[model samples]
Target: MNDRLGRLRDTTINLAHGSGGRAMRELIEDVFVMAFDNPALAALEDQAVFPLADLVRHGDRLAFTTDSYVVDPLFFPGGDIGTLAVSGTVNDLAMSGAKPLFLSCGMVIEEGLAVDILRRVAASMQRVAIEAGVSIVTGDTKVVERGCADKLFVNTAGVGVVPAGVSISARRAQAGDVVIVNGFLGDHGTAILVARQQLALQSDIESDCAPLASLVAAMLDTREDIHCMRDATRGGVATVLNEFALSSGVAIRIHEAALPIREEVKGACEILGLDPLYLANEGKLVAVVPAHAAERVLAAMHAHPAGRHAGVIGEVVAQPAGIVVLHTGFGGQRIVDMLVGEQLPRIC
Candidate 1:
């Protein structure tokens, strides 16, 4: 049996691997279980069991979020589906000022996928989960026939505990709030596009796919009065700002010069006639904080690696509620509204 399972490691996935038979058990035990080794996961139970007392020590509220990753090619410059699965959900929890505790991974893998590929992805997930100080406590795997699914797709659901007295919501933005972003924007979307090789473009840009829990923790430590926070994922900063504006019934105005966009990303956007504001970001976040805490938060963010490029980009206003405005570098002001349609598909 050991020899058979060892041989399976060098081979490819087949329908039997998902049949809930010996093959399925071997795959799970050899690949996922070994990679994500932890007491909660080692029990091999249907659900991860945690003591209620262990959870309540962190906070009074619970933060739960889930996200799916189907980025074409599976592997990109900076990360893969596994990395995305962990970071995406972890970021979601952190956006609520929660301390991410555990994650559940769900994978839909196509038949004939190289076992080595699966191992690599599982390893990536473990590594990122460790970096984010979280555990992969439970998961499920399914192998579909070739062409029935993409090469690989990952879904992750995360659970965290929100600290007491920390209240973050989209509707918390106020007129005197200041907007800030962590690091560069649009690298993830642009990197995926370039990786497709359809545009025949060349650049050294890499996706900013990283877990933001620590960065958020540092910001929260600086001050817990952060009004609103959201990872600029699918619709980028523009979408998040729009959501905040509409939810809080306030207008947001951002400065173009202050926007932290890479030159390579800007060049790609100009050629494709795309707006960097709408491009997706994996590691970036939009934070609406009180004006007084802006500098302090920015300083704290700069002290961390993930937020080294943090900057104050915009501020909330009273008039024109539910609108986002941009101060163009050309000395013109324009309304930056929600993205009309998909700018880049299969990104993040």
Candidate 2:
């Protein structure tokens, strides 16, 4: 049986692996379990049990988040769905000023998928988990008819500890609060777009998919009173700003020239007739802080690798509540509204 499992390691997935029989057990034991080995995971049980003492030591609140990845092409220049799955959930927890602790991965795969490819993705997920100081403590696998599902899809749910006395929320933005972004926008969306090769365009752009817990920690260390934190994912910074504005009942004003965008990303957006502000990002974050703490938080962000391109792009305003306006480079102002239609789909 062990020899059979060993031989199957390098093979492609078949319908039998999802049949809830010996083949299924062997597949789980060989692939997911081995790749994401941990104390709770090694138990090979249906649920992951954590020590209450451990949870209480770091925080008084629990942060939980779940996200699903159905990105096309599976792999992009800088990251794949594997990294995105882990980073996406981690970033969600981080946005609440939490210390991400664990993740549960659920995979929906099409029959006839390559075992090697699944192994590679599992390995990538493991690597990213280690880098982000989290663990995949539990998971499930389901194989569907080949044509009914995409080649692969991943869903991740994560839990983290939010330190006592710390509060972060989109609704916390206040007038005079400064808005800061950790890095370039549109990189992830553009990278995925180029991967599609629909426009016959090419660029050196790559996805900025990464974990933001460390950067968040750095900022919180300096000042836990930072007003709000959000990962600019599906809707990009503009959309996030709109959300914050509506939630907090405050307007957001951003300076176009002050926004940090990579040249390659800018050129790609120009070519695609897309606005960078409306594009998606994976590793970037939007932080709002009181004017007094803005400089300190910005400094802390600059000190972190993930935030090297951090910039103060805007501020919260009192008038015209629930709106986001951008100061254009040409000395004109325009409303940056939530995208009415999908500018780019399945990019995340």
Candidate 3:
């Protein structure tokens, strides 16, 4: 029976897998259990159980997060809505410096949606959960009338535990603190635009829809002086930085050169008249650290596989509290304002 699905990557997935039969068992064993070979997951119980963590001294510090994915086309160049669902929820929990523990997935399917397509999406979601070291302990599935829903929609809720002394939030940025980003910006938005086929450009721009818990965990392990952390998802880096500036009562100036924008993404932005700085990113994050801990934190981030291209892009400075400006390469300064309207909708 297992030979039919032999080695996973080939069989793809069919609706039979979710029908409570041998196909169902094979799907879980071959993809979920196989990829995530851990005692915690191997139990195959209805729910996952684990200690919250000894460091959560104040109380049961559980960081909860949830996100819904209805990305058009469901499937894209680098990932599908399935991958986006898991990564988005997990990344949010991790942004609080918490280690992801368990997840619950809710799937809504249009009546006419292909079962095969649904299987493929489920398989992709399982793979993402395994890699993130979190479990889909519980889930719900519902079928919607045709044309009433957008192909398929996935909602994932995640919980994680934050270690002692690791407190991070949007308002944690402070004056004289350094702002560092995990990697290049706007890769996800540009990639989505290309995949949507609305615009044509010469390049293979892939979405950066990936899990970043490991990178965040590494940073926390090395330093606790980390003031804040946030994944720049829907609103892009510009919004993420602007929120901090207002919350911390400081102004920020980012060097255009220091901000990493892939040449392809930059080209795409120029071609479409889009600003990469204002575009969305799924796999990137911003961290605010005390000036003294900046180098150490950056070093730890750069050492991680996901943060290899980490950069100290800017810093928080005293100002009128709600301004974010950028220094352009052509010897000019520009006000990098937040989006006045929805420039790019359904981004995440």
Candidate 2 TM-score, true structure as reference: 0.97
Superposed Cα RMSD, model 2 = 1.8
The pairs that clash in candidate 3 are none
What is the Cα-based TM-score of model 1?
Answer: 0.97
How displaced is residue 277 in candidate 3, in Å? 1.1
TM for every model, in the order presented, reads 0.97, 0.97, 0.85
Over 118-143, each residue of candidate 1 has an lDDT whose tens digit, in order, gives 89999999999999999999988899
What TM-score would candidate 3 get against the native?
Answer: 0.85
| Ranking of predictions according to lDDT | 1, 2, 3
Tens digits of lDDT, candidate 3, 107-162: 77666566567667767877888788887776655655667787778899998888
lDDT of each: 0.92, 0.90, 0.79
lDDT of 3: 0.79
Comparison by lDDT, 2 against 3, better one: 2
**Candidate 2 structure quality by residue, lDDT tens digits, 310-330:** 989999999799999999999
Highest lDDT against the true fold, candidate: 1
